[model samples]
Target: MSRELRLAEVFVELADTLVDDFDVLDLLHTLCERSVELLRADAAGLILADQHDVLQVMASTTEEARVLELFAVQNEEGPCLDCYSTGEQMANINLDEVQQRWPRFHIATAEFGYRSTHALPLRLRGQVIGVLNLFCAEHAVLSDADVKLGQALCDIATVGLLHERVVRQGEVLAEQLQGALNSRVLLEQAKGIQSERAGIGVDEAFTLMRAYARRTNQPLRTVAEAVIDGSIAADELKRPR
Candidate 1:
């Protein structure tokens, strides 16, 4: 498909999250995957603030990106952190030049073979909830158009995350975000179990589980819980044909 058509499709997919079965984890993962494809980034990842205002890795396009995001959180430094704190976009940052600004983050970026990155805040109005991060393998800068597109994607995702239902019911945004973070932990455990049982990589295991959830018209978290409790066998998560 052409880039414009695919970009439109991505917007539709993100808008679909407004439904009752909306899965925050699935939505964030899809955002990361689409960001890489549409922005021509080597990898992408998302980090969201938990109830206590702590950043946690929510989704990533690759394992390396996931690990680097975690490193950023643990060390309390990185473009994502800076973007979140400032509620501004950090675009086309060369890792080699940012060593003095983010010493540890620079080192971790080098270790992951990422030469540049962009961090966009997942914000609406004045409230910032998280960050969407893009990593490039080459020391490159995003065009102004790409930066605007990335920020637009982030804005759509943030709106979906804080959907009107939460406000209509007077639900706390932090509590809802915390629920998604908790679901991520269960997903990790389930992925490991599926990997062992099916002799597959963790990434593949997650793919299978996600596919099974969609096939069954269930939430990803529900499928994950079933796998953890032995209610869903590893082999049952067949790849969608």
Candidate 2:
């Protein structure tokens, strides 16, 4: 299919989140995947705020991306953190030159071959709820088109998350945010189980879990739960299809 058609399909899926079975973290994961597919980015991730507005890595395209986002939260620096804090987009950042601005973030991102970064805030009701982070391996700045598309996707996701519950946005949003964070924790546990069973690294464990989830058309969290509870055997997952 053409890229445009694929993007249209993705937008349709994004719209579907509004009407039913809305899983916030899954939706955000889809956004991250589609962002990497459709944008100039090589990797994408999201960081969401909990009830206390503390940033946490909600979803990422890879284990490396997840680690980078988590490092941002742990060290209190990075484009995503800044974008969420300022409620503004930080685009076309040259990671090589930002060493002084974000010492640890720059060094870590450089190790991952990321030279450029963009962060778009996922804002709702005049409040920043999360951030869509995009990175490129090349030192290329994102075009205007890239920024517009990224911002549109971020806005759609934010609105879908807070839809029809604007009055009690605080409680509803907070609950959903907490749920996403909890899902991440469960994913970690599942990764550990998969790692033990497969004799692989945690990164490989997570990649395997995500692959199983996609292959089975199951929500990632559901697959993780099954893995954690032994309902789904890691040996079964390890065997080739």
Candidate 3:
């Protein structure tokens, strides 16, 4: 498919999420998957700032610790953090030369054998909702066109992911009636439970839960309930192979 056609189809897929089967996790997964396909990247991941303004791994194509760790390193410093903070794109970064800037992220990506990365802030209009990180295998570099395409994908997808079908009543609490907000709350709780029980950080816990949800073809909240109820053992949801 032409890139334009593929991007149009991706928007359609995102619109399908607002129906009764709205699954935020799946929407994010689609964003990452389409990013890799359209941008010619090895893998992609999304980091969403939750209600608390803390960045969390919302979705990723791979669950490898090395790969997840690459995202985690951004919690302190990296292209993703900078892109998100500035609401700007950080494109075609040569990992070797960034040793002084993002030392840990640089060393970690090098150790994983990935040499370049591009990060785009998930901004729409004037609001930056999240960040998208694209990892290129080998000593790969993205063209100026590729960088623009990546940012376009991020901006377009942000609309669907945050479309806020919030229902309001003069007598009702807004958060109670907002499905998207409710989902975010459950996501945070699940992360905390998994982290506490499994002895891992919230980011790693989310990775494990997200990996398990994808592996079993289940909705994120269903899998989260299982984890909370002890139905899905944390050990069973181990990092993806």
Candidate 4:
């Protein structure tokens, strides 16, 4: 198949993975494989940044590629870091011509036989999330068309990842809401138990529960769950230990 058709197929496949139970690892694995195939890169890898701004190797086309990418980060040099830091596309970086720019990165990747590298930032609007790295073993310089196509793929992937994150956050928000409701339910039940056992009002019961949890260094939720489940002796509540 032609490159355009292949890329279209990849987009379709990627879209199919966006269902409710999509596997994130599988999606990233496919992205790296498709980049290698459609971009004609010798190897490709994806680096994802966490909330802490720490970049981690998320997926790669080859183990050697993965090692080289990590070396790029550890050495604090190379196109990936440069692209990420600047939130710009970096391409056709010839290691031979610019060895001085990244001595350790050039040496480490050169040992693995990669002669050229490119990195594209995965960004949405002003927020740059990560980088897509492509390496060549044959000192290849990307043509204008190659650069455009590679950047397009990276942009698509960044949009997809960002959409997935928004969906995940929605799910997390729903879960948190459910958790809060569950906690409220358990607290009510615990209050009832304490009130009946201690001949106290619900407010007094809650205050006693909170005080005990704070004194014991246990979470209020844990104490409430225990009270509701009858694991905590009712007599234990009276003594405030």
Candidate 5:
């Protein structure tokens, strides 16, 4: 498919998340995956603030990206943190050039083979909930158009997350985001369990769990919880055909 057509499709998919039963974790993962495909990024990671205003790695396109995002959060430094705190987009940041500005993050990015990155805030009006991060394997710059497109995606994602229904429920924004973070923890545990049981990588385990969730018409979190609680066997999850 053409890039324009694919981009339009991505927008529609994100918009569909407005439904009452939409999964926040799945939506964030989709955002990361689509950002990598449409924005010339080698990998993508999403970091969202928890109820206590702490940044947590919510989704990533690759294992390396997830590790790097976790490193950023633990070290309390990186483009994502900066972007979230300032509520401004940090685009085309050359990791090598920012060594002095982000010493530990620079080393972490280098170790991950990422030479450049961009951080766009998931913001709506005055509230900034999280950041959408893009990583590049080469020292590169994003064109103005790409930066705009990335920010637009971030905006839409933020709106979807803080849906009007959630707002009308009063103080549910924090609760909703916290619930997604909690779901991520369950997913990680389930992935580890499935990986060990199936002798597969965590990524493959996640794929199987996601496939099972869709095939069974169940929420991904529910599937993950089932796996964690020993209600679902790893062998029960088949790869999607």
Candidate 6:
């Protein structure tokens, strides 16, 4: 798929996961995975600042990315760190050319086998959370469109993460989301129970449960919880009169 299409699909997938309680790490992990295919980079990584302003590797496509990021941190240089510090992208950079920009980092990262690099800040409304790092074995300038696309993807992920952090609404929404996730676990258990009892497939049992929920105007999670808690009589599923 084109990067744009893949990005659209990514957002759709994320929207699907936004039910009640969502996992931030899961979404961030997805973002890093998609960036590799979307940008066609040899490797990619996500770096975020902790409470102490220390740059930590949140995710990476390869062991090399992890090592290079560590090299950057230790050397106190490299595109990702510069991008994060300036809140500006550092794109299509040849380590050999800008040897002065990050001398020690350039030497170390190139030694690790990456030739060209691009770093886009994960910025929201002027505040930078971290950077999205892309590295390629071939030394070439990243197309303007590709960099823009990278920034856009990072922006979408940043908003989604920050939304989760803020939407708790006195932490009620957070609790509700957690409850929904817990309810999903119950639904899984109920599906297994119904599958064994009715000699139906697990998927079929889920469909029946969803159909029941839709017909009764109750949420899927609520229906699942009811089934698991014995609040809904099992025999009730067979009666119409």
Q: Report the lDDT tens digits of candidate 4 across residue range 1-241.
A: 8866877898788777545444454456567778788777888988877645777676676667878878877777787998899998888898875487888888888888988888888787877878889888888888888787777767776666666566666654234323433555576688789889878877577667766775786666788888888887766766755
Q: What is the TM-score of each candidate against the true structure?
A: 0.95, 0.88, 0.70, 0.67, 0.95, 0.65
lDDT of 3 by residue, 63-88 (tens): 54225534564457788888878998
- Of 1 and 3, the candidate ahead on TM-score is 1
Q: For candidate 2, what is the total of clashing residue pairs?
A: 0
lDDT of 2 by residue, 1-241 (tens): 9978987898888877875556776788889988888886888889888988788888888778888898898989888888987898899899766687898999999999998888899987678898988888998777898788888888888888878764354456688778878988999889888899888888788778877877887877898999999999877776665
Q: Which stretches of model 5 miss by more than 4 angstroms?
A: 239-241
lDDT by residue (1-241, candidate 5, tens digit) is: 8888988999999998988868899899989988898888999999999989998999998888999999989999888888999999999899766597899999989988888999999999979999999999998789999999998898889889887787786757788888898899999999999999899999889888888887888888999999999899878897454
Candidate 3: pairs in clash: none
State each model's CA lDDT, in order. Answer: 0.89, 0.84, 0.72, 0.73, 0.89, 0.71
Residues 190-241, model 6: lDDT tens digits: 8777677777766567667766775786766677777777777666654453
Task: Single out the weakest 10-residue window by summed lDDT for candidate 4.
Answer: 172-181
Clashing pairs in 1: none
C-alpha lDDT of residue 49 in model 1: 92
